[model samples]
Target: MEHPALHQAMLKSTFYPGEAGPVEFHETHISRLYLTHDHVYKLKKPVNFQFLDFTTLEKRHFYCNEELRLNQRLCSDTYLDVLEIRQDGDSFHLGAGSGEIIDYLLRMKRLPEGRMLSNLLTAADPTLPGEMERLGRHLAYWHRTQPPVGGDENADLERTRRNWDENLRQSAPLVENLLTADAQNRMREEVEHFLTEQAPLLRKRQSTGQVIDGHGDLHAEHICLTDPIRIYDCIEFNERFRLADRLADLAFLLMDLDYRGRRDLSAGVLQAYDETWGTDLDAPRLLRFYKSYRAWVRGKVLGFLAQDPEADAATRTDALARGRRYFSLALGYLCRRPSLILTCGLMGTGKSVLAAELATALGAIHLRSDELRKELAGLSPSSRDLSAFGEGLYHREATERTYRALADRAELHLAAGRTVIVDASFAEKGRRDDFRDLARRQQRPLAILWLNCPDELLLERLRQRRGDASDGRPELLAAQKRIFQPPCGESRVLPVDTRDEVAYNVQRIICHLANPEFLKEQP
Candidate 1:
C-alpha cells in the first residue's frame, strides 16, 4: 500500500484522533507494518504453511483479532484494537466500507523502540541490573497467578516432544544441505541426546506445576523497560508454543545475554529470578536445556532466511554461519560446569577482603551477611546511622527475619550455579547451624573459614577501619569479643590468622575450601 494513501485514509477514521499522521511502512519476516505517530498497524502476510496459515482473508482477520485480544492481556495500554482494511476502488481504508475487505491489520499504540531493554543495554547509558531484578520479581508474580495446565504427565511430555520434533524436522533439510557433514552430524547428535536425556525431567516439570503459558519469545528486544517493565509480543497464535516450561522462556533472555557477551548480567537475572520464585527448579539443567532449545530455534530461523529466494549468497552464508555459532554455544553450555566454594568468617577480620580476592579469582558471587542485613533493614551500605533499625528497619524481634532473608538471597545465588563466598561474623551457633542446614538442603559442598586474630590485632584493625557497612565502632570490638561464641568442635572451621599476609590467608581458605577432608581434622 502507498504511504500517502494509507496516511490520508487513516486520518479519516475516528478511532484515534490526533494520534494518526503520516504512515510509515516497514517489512519483516511475517508482517507488512505501518507506523503512525502514536500507533503501529501490522498486517499479516498472505502466506500458507504447515506451521502457520494466513492465506484466506477471513483467517487473517481472525488471527488479527486474536492478536489484539491476547496481547491486550499483557499490553493493554499498547494494544488498542483490530481494524479491517476495506477496499474502496483501488485503495483501501481502515474500516468497514463499500468494497470487499482483502486484508486485516492489528492496531496498537506505538511505544518508543529506544525504550526497549535491549536498546538500553546497548546504549549503556543506564544500568539495568536493578530494573532486571524488579522484572524478575514481576514475572514470578505473573507466573504464580497463571492457571496450571491440568493434564496427564505423559500427554504434556508428548506435546513438548512434538513441538521440538517438528522444529528439528523442519530445520534438518537445511542443515544437511548447508552445513558441513561434521557440523550437521554434531548438531543432530547433540540435539537428539539433549531431548532424550531430559524428557523425563521435562515431564516432571509439568506434572510438578513448573510449566505455564509464558512469553514464548522473551529476548531483551521483546521487553520494554518503562515504569513497570512491559513484556509484550507473546506468542499468540500457538498455545503449544506458549504453554511451555517456564525455564524455556527464561532461557531465551539468558541465551541472548550469552550471545551478546553479557554473562554477568545473565547471572544477575538468574539469581534474581530464583530468589523471588523460592524454588530450586533444577536451574543448571533448565539452563542447559533451554539454551540448547533456543539455539535450535535460532538455527531454524536462520535456515528459513537462507531458504528465501530473495536472499543473496552472502546473506545465506552469513545466516548459516550464525546458526552454526549458536549450535556451538549450546554445546559449550553442555561441556562446562563451574565449581563453587562457600566461605565463612567473622566480620572485620579480613574475611571480606579475602572473599573479594577469591571471588575475583573464581568469578563468584561475594555475598556478605553485612550487605544482606543492611538491605533487609532497608539501609544502603553507605548509610551511617542506625536509621535502618527503626520501625521500618531492624528490630530485636527481627533478628531471625534478617538471617532468613540473607539465607534466601544466598540460596538463590547458590542455586544459579555460582561460587558464593558468604562473609559474616557467624557469631551465634544457631547462625552457623542455619548455614549448615542450607548446605545440606542445596546438596552443595560448604567450607567454613574462621579468621582468627589476636584481641590486640582485632582491636587495632577495628580502630583503623574507616567507613564500612559492618558499622562496628572501635569501642564495640571489646564488647563483641566478650559476647562472641566461637564455632564449636562439631562445626567445620578452618582457622586462618589475619595477622599473616592477606594473600597467604586467602590461599589457606581456598585450599581448605578445595579440600574439606584436610580441614576436617583442624578444629
Candidate 2:
C-alpha cells in the first residue's frame, strides 16, 4: 500500500508547527524517520521478521505508541508523544481527527548531533571522561529502578542460548566461504567452547533474577550525551532481543571502547560503574564473553551485508573486513583472564586509598559500597542527610539493603570479565560469607585484606578525615567498633596495619593479592 494519505498527514502535522519548512522524511531499513528543525518522528516499517513484527498498520501504530510509552521512562522530556496519521478523503492529517487512520509516528524533541558521545570521542575531547562517568551513573540509576521481567528461569536461559546458537549457526556458512579450512575449523571450535563455558553462567544469571529488559542496543552511536545524557533508540520491537542478561548490556560499551582503541576509557567507565554498583568475581570473564558475543553478533550482521547481491564489490569487501576485525577482537579477550583482589575493612581503615592504588596498578574494577549505597538511596555521598542513621538513610535495615544491592552489582561486573576490588567494611560474618560464596560460585580467586590499627590511630584518622565519599562519622565509628564482627577461623583475611605509610600499606595488599597463599596461616 503506497499510503500517500499517511505521508501527507505526517508532513502537514502540527507536531512541529513553528518549524521553518516542510518536514523531511528519511527511511531506514526498519523505520521511517521524519525530521523537522525542532523534532524527529519515527514510524516502524510495515515488515515482519522472525525477531520483529510490524506487518500490519495496526501493529505499526501500536509499536509506535509503545516506543513513546517505554522511552518516556528514561527520556520523558525528549519523547513527547505518539501522533496519529488520519486519512481525510484522499489526504491524511495528524492528531485526533475524524477520518480513516493510516499510520502513527513517535515524535521526539530533536537534540544536537554534536552532543553524541561517539562524536565527542571522535573529536578527542578531554571532557569525555566526565561525560561518560555521568552516563555510567545515569545507567546505574536506570538499572536500579527498572522493573524486572518475571518469567521461568530455565525458559529464559534456553531462549537466550538458542538465540546465540542460531547467530553462530547462521554465521558458520559465511565463515566457511570467507576463511581458510583451518581458520574455519578453529573458529568453530572456539565458538563451541564459548557456548559450553558460558551456558551455566547464563543460567545462573537468569535463575538469580539478573535478567531484565535492558536497552537492547547500547553503543556509542546510540548514546547521546546531551544535558541529561539521553539514551535513545532502545530496541522496542522485540522483547527477546531487549530482555537480556545485564552483563550483555554492559558488554556493548566495552566492545565499543575496544573498537575505538580506547581501552583506557573503557577501563575508566567500568571502574565508575563498579564504584556505583558493586564488585564482582566473574566480571573479567563476563566482560570477555560479552565483548566476544557482541563482536560476533556485529560480525555476523556485517557478513549478512557482505552476502547481499545488491552490495557493491567495495562495500562487500569492507563489510567482510569489519567482520574479521570484530572476530579477532573477540578472540583476543577470550585468550586470557585477569586477576582480582578485594579490600575489606571498617571505615577510616585506609581501604579506599589502598584499593585505588591497587586499581591503578592492576587496572581493576574499584567497587565501593558507599558509592553504591548513595546511588541506591538516590542521594550523593556528600549529601548531608545520608548519614543520619534514621529511616531510609543509615540504619540496620538500610545497611542490609545496601550490601544486598552491592552483591547484586558485584555479580554483574564479575560476569563481564573485570578484576574487582570490593571496598567495604566486611564487618559482619554474614556479609563476609556472601563474598566468599560469590567467589566460590564463580570459581574465581578471592582475597580479603583486613586493615587494622590501634584504636587511637583509627580515631585519629577518622577525626582528621575531611570531606569523604564514605558515610562513616565519628559517632558511626564508635557504633561500628562496638558491633564489628572481625573475620573468623574460616575467613581468608590478609591483615594490614593502617598506621603504616599509604604506599607501604597498598604494596602489602598488592603482594598478598598477587599470591594469596602467602597470607595463609603456616601449619
Candidate 3:
C-alpha cells in the first residue's frame, strides 16, 4: 500500500488504545511521527536517497531496530521498542500476528515538548547555564569512556571532502531562489580555503585519536532537560556520519547556540566542556570553520526542502527564508576576521564606554590606554593623577611611552588572533597615523570609531565625571577640542554621537560592522 493509504489505515481507532479524537503528526524527510497520549509511533517513509535508504519493508524493519539501539545509548527510557505493523484483509493492526507485516514502527514514550533544551533556552530559564555545565560534563565523561573509531588517516579526510562536495552540489539548484549566486560562490571559496589551510591540524587531530564514535546530531532541539537529561536522535543509518572528531560534535551544539543568538551561552558551554575534559581547548581558533560547515549543511538541507516538489507553498517559503539565514550565517564566519578597532574621541566623549560595549558584544579584548598608563605608572586604575595636563605622569614622554606600550600590547593580542579595541583620546593625528600604519603592517582590518558630542554635553560630562581612570576635567576640554582631529577620508571610520543612548549607539556601530560592503572593504 502507498504511504497515504497506510497512514489512513493506521489513523483508525482500532490501531490505538485511546479515544481517537486527533493525532499530532509531524513529518520529516525520512519519517512521520504520530504522537498520541503517552506514546509516539515513528514510521519511516519509503524513501531512497544518496545518504539513506528505506524503500523496502525489510530495510525499514532493520532501520527501526538500528534507531532503537542507537538512541537507547542516550535515551534508554524514551526509546522503547520496534513494533511490527501487520496488514489484515482490508484492515491494519499494530502488532505482529497471523497477518502479513507491512512495515515497522519505532514505538517510544512521548517526551514533553516544552522540556526540550531549545524551548527551555528560549524561555530563558535561570538555571540554563548550570544545566549546560552539567550537560557539558556529561558529554566529556561520555567521550572519555567511548571506544575509538579505528580508521585510516585518509578515511576522514576523504569523508570531509565528500561532505563538502555533497553540500555544494545539493545546494546548487537553490542558489537563485534561496541563496544569491555571490553568497554561494563566497561560501564555496571560504570552505575550500579553510579545508586547505587547516588540513595539517585536521590530520594531527586524527593522528592523536581525537575522532571517536559520538552523537552525530547534537543540537539543542535533540536534547531534553528532564530529570536525567535525555539526549536523543543520533544518526543511526550511517556510521560514517556518527563517527567524527569530538570537536565537530561539540561544534554542532555551539553552532545551534549561535543560531539562537546566544553567543554567551555558547562560550559557557565551551568553558564548561574544557574544564571538565581537562583540555585547554581554543574555541576561537577552530570554531569558525566548524560553524561555517554546520551552517552550510543546514542551509543545504533547507534549500533542498525549499525546492522539493512535494512541499507546499508555505513550507517552501519558510524553508527558503531559513536557508537564506543559514547561508548568511556561513558568510558571517568569513567576514569575522580579527580587527583592530581604534576608539578615538575627546576626553569626555564616551570613548571608553563605546570600547567597553563593543568589546563585550564581540567578545574582544578591551585595552584602555588610560588603565595601561596608570598601571605603567605603578598606580591603581582608580588612582587619579592630579598632575598638570601635559606634565608629570601625563608628560609628552609618558604619553609617548603609553602609546608605544598600547601599540605593542595590541599587536600581541592581534597575533593571538583576537580583536583589540584601543580606547584613547588619539587627539594627535600622528598617533592616529601610527595606528593606521600598524594595522597595515600587521595585515589586520582596522576601524576607527570617532565618538563626537556637542561642546556643552562634553563640558557637562567632564564636570560631572568622578573616580574615572581618566583625569580629564572641564578645564582640559577646551584645549583638547582645539587639538582633536576628526577622522576624515577613512573608509572604515564610523562616527557616533556620544549624546545618544549607549545601547542604541553601540547597536548602530555593530550594524555598520555587519554590513557586507564594510566587511568587504576591510584590508
Candidate 4:
C-alpha cells in the first residue's frame, strides 16, 4: 500500500500509547518510525530489492515478527511486538483487532535519547573508554551465544565475493553521476588486492568458525550507553547480511568509531572483544580491509539515498554531503590533497548551505561572497543595501573587487596547501574565469557547483528568505535568471537541482576530486 498518506494521518498522538502530545517522525530508505514518549512504532516501507522484499503485506508482517524475534535476543524488553495497523475508511488505528489491516508496525520501547552512544561521544565522560570496553565485551558474549555458521571457507569466501560483486552491480548507475566513477575502480582494486593477498587470513578466520548470526548494521547511533548497553535495530529482512564472521561484525562498529575520529575508542572496543572472545589475535590489516568495505557499503547506501525520489530537498542534500564524505573517507585512510571548489549559482539555490556542509566534510575553509562583500565594504554582515541588481554596493566595479578579494584569499590558502570552497553567485563568465585561471595557476583541482531549483520553489524561497546575509528576493529573480550564465560545456561545472529529485549536488564534487581528469586544466 502507498504509505505517504498513511504516514501523514498517523501523526496524531491518538494512535500511540502515550498521552496527547506531538509524535516525532523519522524516515530511512526502508522504514518510517513514529516516536512517542513511551514507544517507537516502526512501519516498513514497501521496498523490493535483490536483498529483500517488503512490498507485500505478508512479507512485511513476517519481517516485523522476525525483527521482534531477532532483536529480542539483545534487548528483550525493548522489542515489544509486531502490531497490526488497521484501517477503517480514512482513519488508522494501532493494535486494532478489526478493520482491514493495511500494514504492520514493530513496536519497541523507547530508549533514553540523551544516553545514546552517538550523543554521549561529545559529553567528555571520563569513563567512556571503559564504556566502550564494556560494550565490546557485551557484543562478544552475545556473539558466542549465537550458533556458528560453520567453517566452509570457500563458500563463505564466495559469498563475500558475491556481496562485493552485487554491490558494484547495484551501484554502477550511481558511478560518475552521483559518485566519483574513479572511486568505483579504486575501491574494487583495493578489495580484490586484499582478497587475493590475504586469502590465507580469510581462510583461517573462517576455519576458526567465527561466522555467526550477528547484527549486520552496528553503528554508534544504534547503541545506548545505559547501565547495560542496548544495541537495537538488527537487519532482519536479509539473512545474508545478518550472518557473517563475528570479526566482520566487529569491523562495522570499529569502522564507525574510526569514522568518528576515535581510534582510541576503537582500540578499547577491539581489546575488550578480543579478551571476551578468547582470542589474542589482533589482525589490523584484515580489520582495516573490513572497515573499508563497511565504509563503502554505507557510502553506497547514502548515494542511493541521494537519489531517492520521495525524500525532501534538505534530506537529499544531506545525503549527498555524507555520501561524498563517506566515499572519500573510504577511498584512502590518508588525508586528501589540496583542492578548490566554488559554489556558483543564482541567489536562493542553497549554495551557502551546500558550501558550508562541504567545508565541514572536506576540512576546507568556506568563503562566502555575500559576507566577504560586506566585509570589503566595511559594513556588517547583516547590513542591508536594497540596491538594484547591478547598482549601488552590487555594482560591476564593487563585484569585481569582492571576487578579486575572494580569489586572493583562496589562492593564499591554496599556496599553503589547504582546500578552499568559495560560495558566490558567479553570474558572469568573466568572474568564474578569473577563479578558473587562479586554480590552473595553482595547479589545484577546482569544481564549480552550479545549484538550480524549481522556479516556483526558488521564487518562494527568495520571497521567504529573512534575517540573513543574502540579499536574494523574488523581485531580483527575473534579473538574475535573465543574466545568469549557465556555465555550459565546462568540464569543471556540476549543475544541481535543490528540491526533491535534486541532481545530487555536493557529491559530484567528491567524484570530481576523486578523478583528476574532471578538473579544467586550461589557463
Task: Tell me, by TM-score, which candidate is best.
Answer: 3
TM-score of 2: 0.61
Q: Report the C-alpha displacement of residue 506, candidate 2, in angstroms.
A: 40
In candidate 4, what are the lDDT values of residues 1-523, reduced to their tens digit?
Answer: 7866678877888877554788999987689888888889899999998788999999999999999999998889899988888888777777767789988989888999888988888775678898998998999899889887874776567677778888777777877655566667756765687678777777776777777889999999999888777899989999888777788888899878776767689889999988887864646566666676787788789888889998889988898767766665565432256777888788888898778656654557789999999999999999988988888888989988999899999999999988899999888888888888898899987778888888888888888888889888888889988999888887677777777322234444554565545543543
Which residue pairs collide in model 3, if any?
none
Q: If ranked by lDDT, best first, what sequence of candidates would result? A: 3, 4, 2, 1
Worst 10 residues of 1 by lDDT: 514-523
Clashes of each: 0, 17, 0, 0
Better of 1 and 2 by lDDT: 2
Tell me the lDDT of model 2 at 376. 82
Tens digit per residue, CA lDDT, model 1, 166-209: 86677677644443334444545655676688778877877898
Query: What is the lDDT, from 0 to 100, of the residue 341 in candidate 4?
Result: 84
Cα RMSD of all models vs. native, in order, equals 14.4, 17.8, 9.7, 9.3
lDDT value for model 3: 0.79
In model 3, what lDDT does residue 337 have?
Answer: 65
- In the range 1-523, model 2's lDDT, one tens digit per residue, is 4565466656653644566667888775688888888889887778877678888888887788778777777788999988876777875566786887777778899888899888988999899878768877778777767766677756556666676677667777774444333433444565567667777876676787667788878889888887777888887887777787776788888788877767777877787787787776667767776777787778778878788888789988888767655554544454344433556676788888877655543446778877877888788877655444344466778778888877777777777876678888888777878877887666666777878888777777778877777756566677677767877565557778878655445434443443426334321
Q: TM-scores across all candidates?
A: 0.61, 0.61, 0.69, 0.63
lDDT of 3 by residue, 1-523 (tens): 3556779866655577563656778889888888787888899988998999889888888999999998898889999999888777877788757788888899888889888999998899888888888888777777777766677766666677778888888888876666666666766776777678877777776777778888888899899988887989898877777777787788888878877767778888888888988864545657777777787888888888888889999999898767766666665566576788898888889999778756654656889998999999999999987766787788998999999999999999988988889999888778888988888877887888888988899889988998889899888777777877877775678888888756455545654555557666744
